[model samples]
Target: MAVESYKKIETYKASDVKTKVVDTDVLIIGGGMSGCGAAYEAAYWAKAANKKVVLVEKAAIERSGAVAHGLSAINCYLGLSGRSQFTNNKPITLEEFARYVTLDMMGVSREDLVVDYARNVDDSVHLFEKWGLPIWKDENGKYVREGRWQIMINGESYKPIVAEAAKKAIGEENIYERVFITHLLLDKDDKNKVAGAVGFSVRDPIFYVFKAKAVIIATGGATGLFRPKSTGEGMGRIWYAVFNTGSGYSMAIEAGAHTTQMEHRFIPTRFKDGYGPVGAWFLLFKSRATNAYGKDYTENVAAIEKYKPYANASPVPTPLRNHQMIEEIVQGRGPIYMRTEEALQKLSAGDPKNAKKLLEDAWEDFLDMTIDQALLWAATNTEPDKAPS
Candidate 1:
């Protein structure tokens, strides 16, 4: 199909074009979480200074980027006081969070960046909540804990909520939907500064040339660079948004931005056929991941210093944990199962849906979170049956 399309495009010329121009003070490329956040933040400041802010996304901002399906967990947050706390309680300190992150990464993290993120992460989550995101709470009216640094949330409409907020801040007219940015434009006076960008509409052949004083590139990561475990019928069925092809990274590299950590890539361990996250079950309901030998491998390695900090925490580092799990599999211990028996039993004693009732109320959230796998479960008539995964 690609070959046929290329053959037809052999006679196509760059000169056959229609042009549209947009002038703004700040232009944001990519309508993902970061991009939308930047747009709204810029608009917040721009409103006081009477400046224009524009955002262009390859896809619709309402359903684009990594969190398009929404996230059940806010992984990096201050314990419970920051935003979720309704009283005048002090939140976790920036230094404490930074130290925790450094320890988690085995002393190989940027302290300054971690501190900054820790300081602001809760506010971001709170903003989403203000815009109509629902955080799960317990019987005592406290926010439910997914892990030490994570919280459960009803975030199926996360993208749309943020997108709507960004639209309100910057004005809906300033947003360009379905615009595939090909490259960045450098300023004539100083090459160090970005002038604007050029792109084409994904739905049409119209060409676009945007001119702005400053540009923010916030497209998410690339996934197709490495071969996925699920191949053949389910080639692009792994975690991370498949639509996120790392175009922003490529554009930044081409624009001569100093890049780091290119060699460090995380290998996520997912379910066998469906490829959905198994960590959530463990984190949310105290589920255990056992191997073919019916032993929890993570418990055996809890004494290791590198994993000690997260020995009690759910959702440990994927790269390291996955390594340990793989080693166990290679050493004749395969077929790991994410067992949620205790939670299932408690739920089944009264609730027929079991712990899945949390999902049943927000079924769209579940479907969006696990697009293919949830569908696969439905198609196969699979039930939780005390062992959800």
Candidate 2:
């Protein structure tokens, strides 16, 4: 695929999507690292065994799934040094890694065991190599060790690369992009084996029924449903996609299919506490995070006098104890989360004096950026009751 190929496939607003029914075998939902890995494995393996494969993704297989953006890593492997510093003679085996992970891991740890990650150690290296990544060892005959057994390579390829490859191996006619899987069509007779699936396009929400001997659901994960402290879609503009909102799980549940590791994999995403769609996107481009009180968060950090403000703001949002603010508003101390429309209107009707100051204050935070005069339009309005103590 060339750079021009993707530009040709416009991610037109879903409202513009045109969907139709299709057929396929094996549908795997979730197009993140695991999802793409599953697709690459299934498609290529089936191709190796001479089988037909169709992978359905809610979003363009790239930029939406976990692996779509820029993430070139496979930390699920074990180290022979095992100590993480490259102990040349101490080659770690699957059993050793598994025993360490499962045994010492107490409450909840995503760390892999030796046996589990063992096979993947070399297998993953091979997988990268297969994907055209030139992985190599260090001059000392160990994985190019840096901060630890953390081998750094030219591996910044996104998960979309695999989808790009699968799109080729599986043939364009066989692949359908932007198709959402809403339900698993169970084989009426067997009930256990899935014969096909049904879905619609978010663009139109029309019913798209697909039938096949074996159906796969590649619908990714549920994210963007809430604002995260980091890069969450709090308003559904999630890090993943809006379509990943429980559709796959809903389909599986409706079909009565049981899932394993649900208990373990049921961890909430990190960095979603203070995230909002408009705030998250704009902050990355220019502005920085702020407390509900409209305080400059970066300035607070810079005043700490302890650490050199690690640049402008802490690389990550600092979780502050804004109890007085939240309590005053939420518990009727100051303002409330359920601010009435009237209150918002009043906050917006601020005097020109403070309005310009607020926008200028925010503008002063980020380097080399400007907040349009229009952004301060809302500042003129009355704010929701301030968080009171």
Candidate 3:
């Protein structure tokens, strides 16, 4: 269902001139959430079997990927909020949470993995605790069981405590930083199973190769597409660990390992889109859309009423797009871009001010999503003053 969600524009850059390699038991790539998880799991598993493991990052620690703002509470939304009674509330398990999201977002159930995921989540939580991750606990001094999930944070830490633990697990000798792994080395004979990987030093300019029995890719999204101000090495324009592309996936694919969650990418959003991409994409995943007049647009309305069980719930940038296409002037917060005969009655009595604010919020999100100088361009292209980025 990725279905042309992103409009790809052609661009090019230079490639690696020199290359080299090394050998290891396990090589974990990327340092983002998934990458971190795999690194910890592999290292711990290997240690249990008395083996070796290594985690590689394109840049230094604390850069590249979602750690841009570090982590605090897990955003699982496990329990219902705004409920008055505390004890009456029930927490959600990992399986239930995954089921809800997967069903609502993808229309298919992740039934098989949910059980295993639920069984092991507690272990992952404690893994954070053992790594000096601070957890907010209950009066009894045990880890607090609230909402739907656990967290190891107060606010933002430049060094997410668990990240420090990951480094320790790998150690200076095993872990390589400031290295860029552009491609995963494969078994040339059968073209199956990972033989190792080939990346290099961004600073030293040499092939940093690793011949590993297994490789885990946790390196994150196609970053640097949008200019994000992340930590340390990422501060470089190429902060994307530009060198550490999708070698892990390619290598695995070459080795006959197929990927299931390939379609899972965060929806592009703009606050100005008002309903937010979640609502729109949810409707789309449900295979529905709306009318231009803003009515309850549905492709197959009759079919939806039959299913009642489900419910629901970045990034680099260039400028912004759309240029405030909503109704702005007569609508009050309407900005006139969204103006239409249908919206007028709602505008007359329906609090245009609030509506306008909503549109503005949506518009800001538009800028956030599109990164097109829409608002700024709006001022030059039209009469309205664009909001500052």
Candidate 4:
């Protein structure tokens, strides 16, 4: 199992490569969830106005971007059907949701943007349900709430479903898959206006020069900027999509777009080794993250008080939680563990059959969202209910 060696590959310059030019009313740069969403919206207006829109994706939209592997839960739903206990059993209001986001970002969030997302997020979720994604509902016909705003789903085909809708709306002929956009083209007369974009085919030597009145850059965030824990074959094993290398941000900044919060980055504490999401374990399975000494260090009020209001906020901010864990590791109480065994036993309520079922559910959490984690478990014979991860 030797790691692949890096070697020189074929290289091409702007003058050497063949270029193809396309003209359209609107051009979309990325084909992630944001890109697909933009395509869907742009298509509606384009059809109404009889304007042409073109969408460019580095990979196929159906299984591209961060959602390619699927998600076990939709983490941003604010439906009235199922109220969260964290909000005191009341429906989470737009203002409250805005506040939560702001607090989460240490009061650095734009209230307007949060409000806009809060208002329309439910419609998107409803649309997802309508688009053949199975959303889990309780016996009471209410969506099953996982956390304050999350709802469970059999979302293994989430991106594909969304991509299908986008493809239908935008028309498949307009989308250019496997074309890697390199930069945004500025208008010749007005430097502030983006005229189009330039990219190249990943599968071929042909370069693309897309000319449009409007350009939407929906490329996701950056990953691998900082060195990861494992730098060999596991270099790609990160919480965020490895393909998202801040190309969108880089293109925008290069095209004179002002950037804010450049330093603000989210470092999620995922399951070790495989980098699996711990949301379901924490919220749904009622699991606790403990230090080497089996202490729930997040409850250390003294350390949390330093973070002030954010720490006091319901479901303490992600950064603050990471801070607590880091402190534990820094102070020689290293090797923190997810108390999966304890969580499963409590969830099963001492029933052997229920425990077995709960164990299967635990595995499904990883299999549905992160197959790597399930494979890791299999490779190591890691019975989650028998040992902490």
Alpha-carbon runs more than 4 Å astray in model 4: 1-16, 80-88
lDDT string, candidate 4, 1-389, tens digits: 99998876777776777879999999998998999999998998999999998999999999999999999999988875443233346788788788888888888778897788778888888888899998877676778778888888888899999999999998999999999999888899999999999988997789899999999889999888877667687777887888888899989998899987676678776656878788899989999989889899888777779788678987788888888887887798878889999999899999989998888878878888889888887899988988887
Which candidate number maximizes lDDT?
4
Against the correct fold, how does model 2 do in TM-score?
Answer: 0.55
TM of each candidate vs. truth: 0.85, 0.55, 0.56, 0.92
lDDT measured at residue 165 in model 2 versus the true structure, 0 to 100:
66
Model 1, position 212, has a per-residue lDDT of 94
RMSD to the hidden true structure, all candidates: 4.6, 14.2, 12.3, 3.0
lDDT of 2 at 230: 37
Candidate 2, 7-124: lDDT as tens digits = 3533566576455667656556555555666666787678777777776666766566654434323444455534233535555566655544443332233444335546656665
Model 3 scores what on Cα lDDT? 0.49
Ranking by TM-score: 4, 1, 3, 2
Cα displacement (angstroms), candidate 4, residue 128, comes to 1.0
| All candidates in order of lDDT, best leading | 4, 1, 3, 2
What lDDT, from 0 to 1, does candidate 4 have?
0.86
Model 1, poorest ten-residue lDDT window?
Answer: 80-89
lDDT of 1: 0.74
